[model samples]
Target: MKNHFLWITFLLILSLNACKSIQEKANDQFLSGQYQYAINSYSQILEEDPDNPEANLAIAESYRLSNRIEKAGPYYEKLAEEDPSFETLYRLGLSLKAQEKPEEAKAAFEKAKGFTQEEEYLAETQRQIEAINLAKGIDNYFPNHVLVNYKDLNTPGADYAPVTSENFIYFTSGRQASGLYPADGTPYTKLFRTRAEGIRVDVGSIQSLPEFQNEEGLNQAAIAISPDGNTIIYARGNSTSPKDIPETALFASYFRGAGFTQPIWMPVNEDETWWNSTPAFSPDGSELYFASNRPGGYGGIDLYKATKLANGDFGNAVNLGPNVNTPGNEMFPRPAADGKFFFSSDGHPGYGKLDLFVAENDASGKQVIKNLGENFNSPNDDFGIFFTEYPKTGFISSNREGGVGDDDIYFFEDKTPKPKIVNVLLNVYTKQRVAGEPDAVLEQARVVLYDSANKQTGGDFSNTNGRVRFTLKPDADFTIIASKSGYFSKSIPYTTVGKTPRPEDLVQEVTNITLDTTIVLDQLILEKSIVLENIYYDLDKADIRPDAAKELDKLVQILKDNPSIRIELSSHTDDRSSDQYNQDLSQRRAQSAVDYIVSQGIDPSRLVAKGYGESQLIIKNAQTEEEHQVNRRTEFKVIEIRE
Candidate 1:
């Protein structure tokens, strides 16, 4: 009995020490601004002591600070139900406001205003109510656009901050399970790149940038590339600091010799006390824009600009001033090439926590601000606007509902009405001419397109249906060339220049007028005499003339189109010289034709040179000059078909 009593006393002392340890840890985490960790620690204490007011309050405050306001609402609601303090009611109202429940938030703020005695608290409560009222009617001023989530790049984590360079998109993502920060139990964000086709990004090609990844602690994000694409600026968080609240600083790196150099912190970075992030460079690379919470700002986070010095360093940072910055956070400043500034703000009247806004100088040189509207902004945080070369399409980052992650990137494009387009459909066929049969589809025939200037525009091989389609510009002329091996090439001219618009076409907004046409190519048969009309040697010389080369080019096209067919190029001569001399000259001429075809990318094995000097002639007893000219000619016959 004496030993049992001692064991019970030991257990009570251990329990008291555990409770004290948890309270100390929770308080330490809260002071360090690691709200997620603090919530975990405080919840552990509350599990054993359900009625502990300190633990309950710490958990609720942590959730609020961590931007998990929806989760914080229930804790604050329970406390208000039990004790109804002014502070609890005020915080609950802010939580409701962040969740976009303006009606409920206004009521809570009104009740809190009645209970608060401090002038500062009463003024803030009134401001909160007014802000909620403004938010209720802000949707009427938004622009029309379509928001599409980036299904390829997002995971069940934070994926945002997209910037485009050429054909690749550089973004930030905390998708890796490892390298998580202990403060929030969330993975550290790292810079990544993926290839994009137009506005569609290939997620499977996402690759981590090795020069910016931090294996030990927090890494870089919010990338901004220079106009030349040789330089990059980003925000690197200082997670290795021993202090409670870590800060992020701006850094720049140059892409040199096919790889990026080591990133160096910008000289404009203030001592670790200030947080600077979301860097954006002007199109000319003369100025750098970023967000900073440093001293002397208009509000929570103000936009600042630093001019690029002659020696490649930055000048003193200057705030954008009251016209742009406000009491709430202003971040993600993107300067478009078209002299427009875009940023996110909560201080301005918006639809949600952080709505995207555009600022541009009007004709009078006054800065005009406009909200992006309901299409782009949601009830959740939406920022990070990135525009492509095309003005109508761009990307935005949002943590809205139905996202694959906490903050997923979305692509937005303006699909307003535009002029109708026309389509040209080409059907390619091969004319076999097998005694009495019709033409058939020429599968895999090469179809090339050329504009009126004879410059090659685009080309594609015919599919199984022997068809190809091209969206030609209206009021233009084009030439379509179809060629196949063992066959003659054919060129067809198409023009939409003289086409008159139909009566119904004038009324439609957008329409695709399909103009269909068919082209036929004749096959080159074996043992057939096809005399080259202009292939004439000069004065008994074997040297080919320019006129002969023009005719032989047709043969080159035939060889290229019919790659599997072997042909014999034969040369015939009139009975004017000795048999041996005529035979030698004819052989040289035939070899010359074969050499020219080989130089034009046709395989040498596919061609054979033969000379029939006066032995095989079209005109047996040549008397007239025209008959003699026809006797001396060059012709090619399909000797063998490989397929």
Candidate 2:
């Protein structure tokens, strides 16, 4: 028994030493920036000790640094559940968000905010929540569109960044080639030119640009050509040295007689430490836009522009500022022919990864950034959009699923028809009543349409036919008012919220429809009183009842519509109560009605409340119950009207 106990002790010590050695190896790999190798080491450790917190965190970080955030999700989730540290929770939220699990990610971020007091972390957590909310509503802004990948141009490897000029399309690809990049064991990216008809590219006509080919182990991608097709700017990376960080720069090439000249590095790439790539030329060729990771940038990568100088060299690079950049990468800056700018960003509130965005100056000359939304973007990298001169059709690169390569070029066409204008015809009529006489039409009435903001949108005088027409936009609310001499103005509210042409009905370029509405104004006689219908109250109650409030709401609207009118609101009671009691109760009720009107934003100075008890009953010597009910009433009379 004693010998067995000693042997057990020795085995336990040896096991602990082995575990320590394995942990040290994993740590060494992680510190040296070999994230893939570190992941392998930490994963092995986890196989034996699944609850190892350090190993789990390390593996998650490794996967994130290697751009495999989806693979890191489970590990981060495990760490967050076990440790619940602010860093672990934040990282888990990011992983979940990138995987399009917004609700779960939001919970993680919310929990993280409670654990940290740092302002930066708190602000970032709030931004993430806002971004998730914004992403949820992105579908509303996108038009109906479809994307089709160019299968002929894609390969089993990576193929993306397509630019078209004339009938030929230039793009970058990393397919089966003679040269390979040692960094990731993939073929070095090279430029290829092919004949394209619309969105179909002929693979058999593919040819390499011999004049623009790079050395064996370097990468060349993201090419831009001028409008004249003579000058070309392409990104080149120095990937030959395995020990040093790769440096990318932009190079310019000029077309010569029957060939192109040797590429020359641009002066804008003077900083050796910064990366400059993804060049785009303005339509007039006066400015070149590119993405760089240089110092003094607002984010990881920002869009910059360099103007063409008189001496044929480019001027200083200018940052596009916060409107065009964010705390994340902003790349692939492309300007359309109509002065609109397009780019891709991960910092903005997007579905995930890099989503496409468009920026343009509004009517007030302020830059507005709008997301391209789900139709033009996906929960993956989408960038490098180029449009034709008309911009009706364009090509965009995306790394979404269902593609043949790592990154594939897609074609999109705008199929949404223009909005049609709606015509609203207003017919105004006036009716004069005098002791059962026939009502006569009063022409030449003024009709005006007021928008929801109370601004007069359109107005006109009624013609001989008592009709006035105006054009209106769909999905809006308006109030139509009609008035004539010696007539009480009538106001009616209308809305076109659901009056647009339905999707199934819009089968043509334009659909015209007219909506006809009639407004009838009542003739107003001097000293005439109008009894408000359905104004009633419970016994001994001074407060306005629900039914009574509804009846008074029309008066409130009238007071609001006619701002210069002053009126007296009077209350009356039946003969059952004593004269003093009835007078006092009616006065209180009248004051209650006036107070309610004042509460609805009407000016108190324009209203006067009065009581005329059983002394001024409408039915003289009432006998039936209905007559008594009619005697107890409320009425309004216009005392003064200001033009």
Candidate 3:
């Protein structure tokens, strides 16, 4: 009986040792990033030791790190139920959020907040909570625009991140070449191309680049072609050899007529230990952008830009600064020609995971970041966006649910009813001399448009219709000056303020509206008497009346506009008054008018006060009161125009 008991105990000891060996193997697999292998091993242990905390957390982290975040949610939830620490709770929230379970995600984030007093941790938790709220109302954005899968370009494997250059579309796809990458369990991707007409991709013409860089089991993806399409920059790596530290570096390959030349290692990749990929060029090809997790970054995997030197090689990389880099990963930089900078971010408050964000400059020139919102963003991984066309037409990448497979390429267009187009056309008609007579077209007159700052924005000569047209900027102030050799220059203030059509008021694709104004320049005719209209005074008074002062203001503007002209502001009296008395009274009235004109900031030397009195009367012997009254008047004539 004693011998039998010892045999059973001996077998139990052997079984215990075997279990320890299995645990060590599973740990090794997880540490080596063989996540699927780790998951399988962990599952076997969980069948016997179902409550093993180490096994559960390892399996959950393995799933999350492997891009199986959807599968990680249940494990994270179970771990959090057992022990709701900050890390577990925060990770759980991330999984739930990526899966589009906003309510549950928010609840998890709220729970995470209670688990820590560290500002960074608490802030991250709060960010997740705010992102949940952001997702809740996402449907209100880009109302009519819904993202459509590029059904022809997509495959059962992943196909994403397409960019257009001329009539060709370049992209990354996992279906055609290379072996599986254990990281996401997807086939290694290669750079591919096809013919494109604007946003439409010609799927049948899709062709992968020759294997001049990555080997059979390696990967090459995320490309940037120059505006001339002569150069292509891409990421190539994934050395599976256990002896080498895993590294992905950038390579530059040139178009050698029919195909790409073999890639050469880029010098801008300063560190081999850091992960660097996702190359993009500025619309003008002056700078190159990529994502890197090198030291001195704001956080994990921050975006960086390197300037293209005159030698055509990239210079030192620069961080996009605090406004763009968050404490979370930001990648896939795409700067458009429309002055908008786009990239994917998990740092900025977003719907979930990596959301598309556009960085814009406001009126103050401050950088403002905004989510692409709703249709362009989802709760899953969305990154690597490229413009197939400008003004909101593009191909986007997302791993959102209901895709044909993992990470599909989606075609998007801004279909918000073409928006409201208000074309504010300013038609400036230059007419003939003073009093705007003849109404004949005046050609060859120089017309200049200046902003409120007196800076000339545009200048053009009057056409056959004496018309100079310009498209006015909205909510602006401008001054239009028209001048000719024999004519006095005239400055007119034109304000576009309160003149624009509201966005909601325009239902048509384009609303054409014209603002017509006539600029009549006076010919510099010396001694040509031009009567001033509506110049009147209280009966028998020498003091300038308010009405008379108002008329004199026009003379002030003319003097100001034609800086070289000296005008004679003269007044005459009726024949009834004694010649000397009328002369004295008229002289005082004319002087008073000159004084008012001087007060309006016109140069004093530009005026001459003259009084003709009864000597200048039209009716030699006025009998009727109307004829006598007509003899009292005020007039101005250009006496001298100084050079």
Candidate 4:
């Protein structure tokens, strides 16, 4: 009896200490706005005492804040799995939708409607489910969410650009588990890899890319792995350039074997003042598309393609030409299995910087770029796209405000479309019945184009040519309204065929109308450059921050979009700093920007990073604090480039 009592007392004390420790950690993290950490702390308590309702609720709240809805599923599911409370069921629906399981996600949403007056959330879920259903062209929605996280040492930094092969995923990262190391004392970035263990639903464990590691240079970012997982092509550059030092030309290695053999650079014929990076091998591995800043471009950087010869040498890179190479920058070239090219660009109108876009290669082999619409875009930077080999699920990276750093990865599965979009076209003209050179409406009219339901479709206004072109979703209804300041908006209704057409869905626009040109309006197209009030690092420090990455990404996007645009990345430091130290810091900082741009697939030749240091001080004779602040700055100016 004495021994039993002693053991019970010891257990009680231990439990109390554990609970106290958890509470303290939770409070600390909560006060610090580290909700994820706080929730993790609370989770430990729940693990010990499963009935801790407060802990469960805290986890749910954290999940909501962090947009980790799938994580909230079990807590809510536990409450609703049996009798199903209205709150629990509603949350369950949200959780499932977040998991990208729309059908089951919809069922949970519908079930919640049976108990609560708050049907708004459920209604939204239903609408999304419906939209996904329609978009996928499926009778019943399929649950296709695969968990993909590539782990290993030889893998480069954050194994990203995951290209799925039937049962495996080929990706790039800088981790060393694969035993690859960069030459020189340079910080490491290498393309290490792994294989997925299980079927589509459960993406099991990852096995190291044993064959690819410890090569000559570190194979870091921008990977294009073949669909069969037998081949890989990735970007690599000199470590002396550092992460921010943009190279005049970036090199790529063609990887063979389950593990890579001695990879070779894609010959110097593609080399120009600009760098060649972000190599994407086609599904057949016979073709390659990459970004380059060589001369004869539209403006900044452009995507180019080269054919693989039977001798394993690449043919001269053919310029993708005007259709695909805009005056703006284009990078992250991904050739989808369906023959469409998916890439990230800033030249096209999108939600924000570096939006992901898809383009179809016409029968004539011309590239036509189209935005993926709003679902996959946000107001912040989005890039680094790759899909899982499992047919639909995969990941992407973005620094769009809500992530932990400059770039955060997101996993999404294909929301199959029900009815497909066959084709779509919109025309803008001065509203008048006059047949030839009709001139009744306002000139330079600003037209805001929208999709079928009035959501913004990515398109531009009537150019001097007075025309706007767009690709349409199949089997979808589209409405277009054209307006000037004074004229009543003209609404045009059109529908596209879902399946093989009965020939009824196609329509031609001959309808004409006269518009009132009386309403005068001022339209301003804002093309704003990011302004740095002041750029300063700690004394003698050269490390780049996540915030700097955001700004650099914007600059990079601009360069990629405008193929002919060239700019010098200038770095400056405060006059108070020693001249030599300031100069070195400035140079490193400028180089850092260049390095990041090169990593993002921008051709380095287009950019020149210079360390101005205190040489270009904005304020002369810095006696006051405010004037001294002016000496620290970084700026860019466009240089000569081809049209």
The sequence of per-residue lDDT tens digits that candidate 2 reaches over residues 338-405 is: 87899999878899888899898999998888888888888888999887534667789998989987
- Order of all candidates by TM-score, from best down to worst? 3, 1, 2, 4
How well is each residue in 342-370 modelled by candidate 3, as lDDT tens digits?
89998787877899888899999999988
lDDT of 4 by residue, 421-494 (tens): 33434355533323355344445545554666679776455555545555556557665545443233344455
Cα TM-score per model: 0.60, 0.60, 0.68, 0.37
Instruction: Sort the candidates on lDDT, descending order.
Output: 3, 2, 1, 4
Write down the worst ten-residue block by lDDT for model 4: 1-10
Superposed Cα deviation of residue 204, candidate 4 (Å): 8.0
Candidate 4 Cα deviation (angstroms), residue 276:
1.3
RMSD after CA superposition, every candidate: 20.0, 13.7, 8.5, 33.7
In terms of TM-score, the best-performing candidate is 3
For model 2, give the 10-residue run with minimal summed lDDT: 1-10
CA error at residue 429 for candidate 4, angstroms: 62
Better of 2 and 4 by TM-score: 2
Error of 4 at 524 (Å): 84
Q: Give the range of the ten consecutive residues with the poorest summed lDDT in model 3.
A: 1-10
| Model 1 accuracy (lDDT, Cα) | 0.77
Candidate 1 segments exceeding 4 Å error: 1-18, 48-51, 79-87, 115-124, 139-142, 210-215, 238-245, 256-259, 361-365, 419-643
Tell me the lDDT of candidate 2. Answer: 0.80
In candidate 1, what are the lDDT values of residues 428-541, reduced to their tens digit? Answer: 343333546777777777888889998887888887888776667667788888877766667777887756375355665555566767777777677776676788888878
What's the lDDT for residue 623 in model 2? 94
